[model samples]
Target: MFASVFVIALGLCYCSRASSQSSLGLPRLFGPSEALVKTAIEMNCELLTFPEDEPILLQLFREGNHSRLFAEYTSLEGEVADLPVYVQPYHEGNLECVARAQNNSLIEPTVSNIHYLKVIEPVKGAEIEVRSGSVDLFEGNMLELRCKLKAGNHVSYKWLLNGRLVSQSLLHDDRLLINRTTSQDSGSYRCVASNSFNQTDFFTSNSTEVVITVREPVKGAEIEVRSGSVDLFEGNMLELRCKLKAGNHVSYKWLLNGQLVSQSLLHDDRLLINRTTSQDSGSYRCVASNSFNQTDFFTSNSTEVVITVREPVKGAEIEVRSGSVDLFEGNMLELRCKLKAGNHVSYKWLLNGQLVSQSLLHDDRLLINRTTSQDSGSYRCVASNSFNQTDFFTSNSTEVVITVRDLVSTPNISFTVLKEDFQNYSAVVTCRSTRGTPPVTFSLYNSTEVIASVTVEEQFATFKVPLILGQDLGFLQCQARNGDNATYSEKIPLEVVPVGGPVKMPYTYDSGENYDVIGVTFYCKAEKGTHPRYQWFLNGTLLDDRGSFYYVDHQPPEMAMLMLSVGDSSAGTYHCEVSDSFDNTTAISSRRLYLDKHTLNRLPVWVVAVVFGSFTFLILLVSVCCGLGVVFRRRHYGEKSLLDFEMERMTPVYYGKLDLSHYNEDTDVVNAARWGEVDQASLDSVDEWPQIEEEKKTLEDEPAEEP
Candidate 1:
């Protein structure tokens, strides 16, 4: 080993490129080779201490700490460099160690030819880790295991599977890299790092073994959405089951168009839609995951379950895709039907409220192959479909106007200067036709008549108009006429901002309530003309700049801020006048400041008296009505009781009277008259009337006749 290392070091000693600065003394001991020194010294990176009494094997190593950059390194003299040599810690099998010759310039550093080798050994830690392989493995997967410590001189690596020496030709090196691992490799694996000081003396480290398990791939993973629903109309419930034929150790998730379904929409292995709406129409999928035999979670998705939720088509909106009502003749046009929240199956096209052929409605878009002037009418789109096979739904219709122009392409309009002035202001509106067939005429029109016209053979035309006599011009238009196909662009309102006028600033309009005391400031600006003046007056009296309660502050650019503490005396009409010294013209605007006065419950005598009198009258009327009602009720009940008693007494007495049914006609009539006419007041008097004389005479005279 020493002879081969010496030969390799000699072969690698030649310096590749000369350094910009003079290098140190001849590449000697205690440092790297001449090639490595040439690269490292220019980069200003220090050289680490070499192991004493060992052959210069030039081992390439990496810091085991997994960070963005392993920025820590120790030199022979315990020095460090700012620019660290970067290395990948995870990929460890074969690495190319390159030394970059860096300088203090911003340019890229020149890199040296990289020397390659296997990663050095790790330190003796008490555990085993997968340095270059996954922690968990499956059948038919390649795996590599590494010892935590690298082998030194007289050191060796031995791998054991469940405490038994694994016998394989591929385990010659210190690495335990395996390809297509199977269940035979699944055991308690540990790396036995043995160090030998002499031929007879050796030692081994106590490393905790790592267990590896392998599982077979799932068989035929799929999902099925079984539905028993037919009446899937609005307000109806929809039921579906996400059936899977995967392993039992799988976790399920319901996804609606790649988005995880909300908790309310998922119930265990089923998707239960409580109420179906128009928005629920989409593709659904079932995703499952299994992590038993893998390092990270592995997932599989089922096929999409397409569903259509239906509702009544209530309304629709029409959108002209070309964004123009007036289209050039012999051009393609498109109109879209923006349907409301509904599930529609078919559509019908209409022209001027009359139904057109169903063939005209194509792809939710009404495409006019070649529009002509005859097709200039109101076009309507009627969407018709049913929520279900058995139920019927109302169709929605929307209309828009489409005027197919017979004379030109739409013109491009722009104004050079759009400004208004009471004096003289000239502006121009230019019309350009870059795509139209030219020999076109451009016309600028006001509200009523065409005011300016220009015929141009070129692709552009301009029309100049005066803003005098009327600064308020209506919407201006430009028409480009070519042959019999002329069309004007959309109307452009020529809004000219006023150049100079009486200055106006936004102000507050708040009405003060009673008992409110506030200090408000009013501002008047006059920057229109030179040498302007500002004045403020309250109720026809000029307020002087006297006290703190009433003061005026003059500011830059011709503005005055009048501050006033408004109270009862300050509540009056105020006017602010601004005058232009150059034009001798003044503009005045007035505002009223009124603070309501507080009153202490003052009411009119007549109103109070009328209210009190009305209340008293209402009380008396209610009391009298209650008393009369009670008295009337009592009298009515008393009379009813007397009548009932009289009827009951007469019933018994009449039955005890003589038998009047056997009487003759004359006698019956006479007896009935006598009985009915008998006075109720004389009934008690008849028994006591002249009783003594009649009884005595009857007894003596009729003694013989009695036998």
Candidate 2:
């Protein structure tokens, strides 16, 4: 019995130990099978194999595969190994499996919580750019691509063309070079930097493009002429174009048939000869080159142009028909240009040698109205036919010297108003020719006779006279005379009047009578004058120009009133004044004006309207609410039985109670008739009517008030 007990006790102890080792509840395989141990290690299981059994035992590794990114796994050793402070163990053939978190990406479990292992997937942030030495791309240019602003280990650069892999670095390099670019190389390119652990799991940069254009190298070039209708006429405009259609870095030159023309005389592939005459008839062509490449150009000469000239006009000379004359500044002169011999001729006038006027009066005459000293020049008239417009020809005209001598201008009269009023004012008059000869004589005259006279070698003269203010001013003027001519000024009209303004109103604001409320009523007055202005003063201080309560007058400005709308603050002793700067004078009121404060604050129209409207609305709302309350309670009482409705004690319980105890079926008709208040109509012909019992409705204390 003792031996059997011992065996049973031993089996129980062995079972407990085995259960603790088999964490996944699987039976532990105690055999050291090589295949099982290798497979478990490959799947990232933490295996505790004997040092002599492991290949070298110098390093401990979590289960993983070897790759180009193996170097990066070392940098995560400390972080991943420090986590998942617990492990579950199992036996797999020759190895024991210890399962724990192999990466740092995990929620740390509490002591009472079940722990878990989470594997972190590798990720990288990447960007790309062109290499610094790479300029804008062109054919035959060297180009490079670089991966920049990236974070990852074991990163490899890949360049794609049109979404397909084109250029790749040999090692873990981040740059790719293109030896030379061709037109066929132009494409949408993309550079990608990857962690290399997973190629498809990558970030792609923005697309960078390469544009390649072909520029042909320079060779020999030729010139061509494309002038249509070069059969030359005297006035025909011609052109010769030297063209080089094929070459890089090309240059051009122009030539006259076989003569090499200086480049200084030509403007880029053109040679222009204006007003071509008999001397201009020649063979013309241009020479072309690619001087930028230092290459001489070739020319095909069958395209030469020979020009022939002709004359369609005869004897186009100009003659001066009018002799020159000396004249005063204000005097007029006419100069004429006559065509000596030409058909269908036109005329132009010249001062010295420069062309002056192309449009002229009838008979080619130039009129100088109010001629000035600047008009004194050598005048000539030019005669030309239409044929001479484009063909070169010498314009012929004899010069004429226009001698403008000792010129006198019209007189201008200015005045200063002196004292005196009513009908006339004492004033001084200045008469002068603004531009004239020095020895000028000015005579001041009225309609009847000359009032004053002065002869001075200066530009102006003055005289004093008592002038009338009205119609007589139009009768005075001045006349000025030089050696050759005399001139009279337009009449001078003098306006003279005494300055005036309002002195006082017949009534004063001091009157105790309440005549008007603020600006509601006002006294009307029209301040009439020539250019009248006004100023107002209140309480010995100038008021601001305008304010909220000031009156707006639809009438003219001078006919408006000065308003005191709300007079409490505005009321004061006031003065009215005006000043005229024409004669530098001022006018003030003869007597003082006064305003007094009213008994109450004047309400604006809008405020009064708002107050009245609100009171009316509130009265209407209260009346509507009270009437509606009675109507609704009566309706509710009629819909319910005498005892069905609930009522508070303070409210009369009898108010909603319908007294139906005395009701009878036959009395319905009689009740309706009495309730309708029917009046009896006379039935004269009828003798007997149906005898009906009347319903009596006695007023008992006007009934109890309802609701």
Candidate 3:
């Protein structure tokens, strides 16, 4: 019993030892997988397999070379190894831990798994660029700013305006675009570039700030005279200023009598005259303008100001009938010379420094019944006293440039497509009027809505517009207007060509071949675009239009089909080239396999399921039939054996005869007789029965045996 007990204890000890050995897990090196260049990082090697406090050796293997890395022990419990510092290039490699002995010798040099450390470059030296070429722009123009970097990898960018984050709607990958810019958009812009390292920390750098200044178009200019009175005496100083309601970076110029005054006498926005004489008593105006746009300057002219000097004929100003010198053909023209403080004044007109005829002059006015282009010239009015013919004191008003322009004829409209890119399709529409004057206002229209309008000094005007792919061309129109007369050009009849996108050629099994395949149909479609045309290529060879083995069917706009015969050498990599009718953008479909004629026919899923189900049911039915037959046969054989045994051991019984004629064939013999007849007498006379029987037998024995 003691020996048995000892054997049982030994068995328990062996089992416990095996359980502890399986429970201990192997040590692993764990830390971040990535690090930035020139940065130091740490890694830990813990959960050591060996249960000892011996020192560990950390090693790195990189570029077919192995080197020992610096590691130290941690203060925490169960400390294994801690990497002291990780330098780039030298320390970036596969890292592992080796168990060491007390004498600094390797205990086990083999490692289970290795952890890779990848070094990534940091983001640096980011800069911003104004793609629109200038940081200063006018209102209602496009503003595009792009971000650039000197060196970066896997970088993303964000924009800030005046120390606030910009909206995502105006930002693209590295660009920011503001359409129809406003004055509120003027601010200092900055770009921030960032990238991720170690999958947890981020490195970012800021770009230099770019300042933007948005100016408004000059409008509603008025001239203000700073002098005490407009009617200045001779030798009095004159001060005239130009003020703007809305404008920026404005410069002013003084216009005296419809002629430019020298800039030498202008001071900023003010015009100064040290001494004023009767010659300065004419229409005085100021023109306010700014060069804030890349193409043109926005200019505005203030209303005419009549300055009068203390004289007999003062403030001689010319006034046209319509407050404008511009007139249309076959229109009445009138010019009147007026004075601010004068009496008995008679007016005379001069064209191009020449005196006008008396037939066109009337008292203090000049009239023309019908004007023509011949009437265009610089005209001025001279006011004089009628009473003094011998000593005529005359004063000339400012020169007025009268122009009689012909009515604007029907404008001709035409367009040229600038670009056909899918995202930014654009066109330039030109509107021209050969019979009209310069500085004509041209308006471009789509249906009834005006797309854009411009007033150019030349006879033709051009408008840049974004084009939609499927819009009707008849809706594009242009109009030229001068004064109150306007004329529209004929509607455009040309359509915008559709841009083509990526092509996808997907082949599907339509029908199965019985003996020989007719063909296989491949459908090619564009992911997004319009008016795509397709061409088929087999093994890098373009298919002919009248090929005997292939046929092309164009479905128009977006889809096309190619049918290739299966029996020919058409079993190569097949692809389709889709091109846009509007541009040179062409896309090729990915190469796909073409099945041969000898390929096995793929049956439908439902047919295969039906065949499998029928076979399974047939097997089940046969199994049930065989089992029933065996059971029935076994029962029949067992019953036959029992019956034969019973017949082998038979017993016979005798009965007395009674009423045999009344017996029924269907009834048993025992049940057919009545026992109460002569059965008892026959039974009691059994002793004499042998003699009677012997006598009866002797009487019938000879006949019964011999017969």
Q: Name the candidate that leads on lDDT.
A: 3
Report the C-alpha lDDT of model 1 over 1-707, residue by residue, as the tens digit: 43454433432231122224322211111212112101211112332432221111111223332232222222221133223222222323322222221222322222223323222223344346675466566667877776665323334778888999877664745567777877577778887776543235455665678887654444344554454444345534466665544443456688777888888777766777755787777777777666754455767767777777777546677888866887667777788877766664566677886776565568678877787787789887766565446664544455688877555567888765433443555567788876654467777776557878877777678877765322456788777777665667677766544224645532332223432324556677654533345667777677776554668776633677777664445555555666532222445443433221111111335766898798667656655665665566457567566435324322111101111232234554443210011122321232432442353344346534221
Sequence-dependent TM-score of model 3: 0.32
Span of 10 residues, lowest total lDDT, candidate 3: 14-23
Report clashes for each candidate as comma-separated counts.
10, 0, 0
Q: Write the per-residue lDDT of candidate 2 for residues 269-367, one digit (tens) a residue.
A: 655543345655677665454431133333333345666655433343343344446665656777766554565656767777677754535556777
The TM-score measured for candidate 2 stands at 0.32
Among residues 3 or more apart in sequence or in different chains, the pairs in candidate 1 whose N, CA or C atoms overlap within 3 Å are: 121-150, 122-149, 122-150, 406-484, 406-485, 407-485, 407-486, 408-485, 408-486, 408-487
- Full ranking by lDDT: 3, 1, 2
Model 2 residue 131 lDDT score: 66
Local distance difference test, per candidate? 0.53, 0.46, 0.67
lDDT, model 2? 0.46
Judge candidate 1 at residue 522 and give its lDDT: 67
